[model samples]
Target: MLRPALLALFLTGATAPAFAQPPTETVPLLREIKQWVIGCDNLRNCHALSAPSGVDEEDYSSLTLHLWHQAGPQGYLRLRFDHRGEDVDLSTLLLDGKPLGLELTQDLHIELDDQGGDPEVQSFGGIEDAAARRWLQRLRNGQRLQLPGDEAAHVSLSGLSASLLLMDAVQGRLDNVTALSRPGKGAASEVAPRAPAPVLRKFTAAAPLTAEEQAGLVAAALQAVKPEEGEPEATVGALTAQQAMTVTRYDCAAYNCEFDVSSRERQAPYKETPMDLQPLPLEDAALQGSVGYDEASGTLSYFYKQRGIGDCGGGASWVFDGKRFQLSEFHRMPRCTGVGYGDWPALWTTVPAP
Candidate 1:
């Protein structure tokens, strides 16, 4: 059974756009290219980021570059940089210790934002397609991409050409003028079209569960996981003294309270099988995470943390229809490169069904 606090933590409404129905080819691809990591979602939207040489280093010292591109022929490329550490003149970026002579303000039309009230941590974005391609072309043959001034931070260009080549192939941009790695006179029309995001219908008319109904479902879920006769009960807040001693070995306050109940499974009352309790089905069979249900919105959610740092994880949510729980959203981030949870790529997405 979920504690009131735990229920409140997990059952809160998700403001992110709710999506539904898994795409026929929703499996995303992730690859590591020598200090750089790249991933593409089902929609063919691709993201590549530079990782620290020391994988365990949490602070992204001077600058981290991220590249994003949409899947279709009309899709454009964009570049972003997150800067930390000491102040440096980003306008004078260097490739192989030589200045590229590119005008950052005019070419990229960059925008800067100070994140988390940290004056030292600034983010820059909005690199134009033409300028981005020019920069990529110049950097691909270089060994290091360095920021000018004291504390000259740099990212290795090793495997960059291969990474861009793979992106070109994945988006079917090879031999086309739009190809970032291998451009030719071929027209953009030859590139593959972007795949449509899957749609899921939410039963908005479904009535909210009453207090009695919620309590009954919770009881049923607890009973489902109850131990056999003479065995120790695994139920929360009702543990025996010995069981509590074993369970208290880990400090929930220091780490995360969600870890205590994340491994436990819960059942919901399915209208089709009112006589029996049924576990809600997830689009991905591997997501064995903490489960939560909202009585108000009739949404069931599962969240799995790759580690206690919360830097990497995946989550999915479903809105309950009259008959069953319909998948509304699914997202995952395979790399723990200091990116936030909201920044994860979406494998399955949906809009409310009309």
Candidate 2:
């Protein structure tokens, strides 16, 4: 029952953009790298997903990669293909120029109430399976992966390592399981089983932002992105709060737009002086982007688009603990091209907790 439900939410996003609805906690976008987007639900289960660009929505839905993890036996990497409503034979899955053997007793067929044929989804290696465990290790080591049919097709392993780190932050003991489950390796001679992953705390929305409250946020945003030519001044813009504690200041000057975040409920007194925040590198200062908050996970996300079309963008996000914002994760992609969204091959890194 749980498996089918999880697949529904994940597959639904394949044809169209969708997130976990109410009753299911969610981190809207924990991380996105090229075609891959990693997200988590209230249950602490995380999915590393990818759907290539330039394909029909329904056709693309069946063609996807979902690496799932839940801190225990419920972890694995699976590939799904729609097959245009036909039975298909799958003998082996190839990754990084290597073939992973699979046991297929019969042709795979996915028919929803004998309706239109759905793509058949197959697992590469399960959490407890030796081959699956090995594949995970290779992925974390930054190895490239390719689908079975296309010899020229390859998926970059960039940011996968960091995305897993974010998943571990939500769930617990994933690092431990990976270490112990290393392929061709035995578990520690004497080790206790890890406890199950923790469920995320549910969040209740606070009062909606008032017009004045929104104004204060705009003022703060101006201060964050204002050029250093003169004193910071308030600018006209709109403020939208994705969550009670999270508000984004969106303002566009000419053809350029800027987004800044604020955690306070009300805007502070207008200050000619600047607020204390880390300055982004000179090269990344001019990109257009926005910020979002995931109330369920208490994570703050900052995203930006690179100057040209292709894979050349990056993101910086933090976790807020009432008092301060701590660096949670960051990604950089300097050499990516031909990507529709302007994000290229990138590397994701996790900031060690202080």
Candidate 2 C-alpha lDDT tens digits along 106-160:
2223324222222232322223345444545656665555556644334555566
Could you tell me how far off, in angstroms, the CA of residue 162 lies in candidate 1 after the best superposition? 1.7
- Per-candidate Cα RMSD to the true structure, in Å, reads 10.2, 12.4
What total of clashing residue pairs does each candidate reach? 3, 8
* Ten-residue stretch with the least lDDT total in model 2: 14-23
Record all residue pairs in model 1 with backbone atoms less than 3 Å apart, i.e. clashing: 19-328, 19-350, 20-350
TM-score of 1: 0.69
Across residues 1-354, which tens digit of lDDT does each residue of candidate 1 receive? 112342232222222122121112223666778777776765666777776545545324356677776666667787777666555556777777777675543464334432333455556666668888877877788887777663436677777888888787777777778888888786776677666664555554434344544454345444444333332222222111111100111222333332212112112341112211123223344224454545456555667677766656677777655445566766666666555555465555445665
Rate residue 170 of model 1 by lDDT. Answer: 74
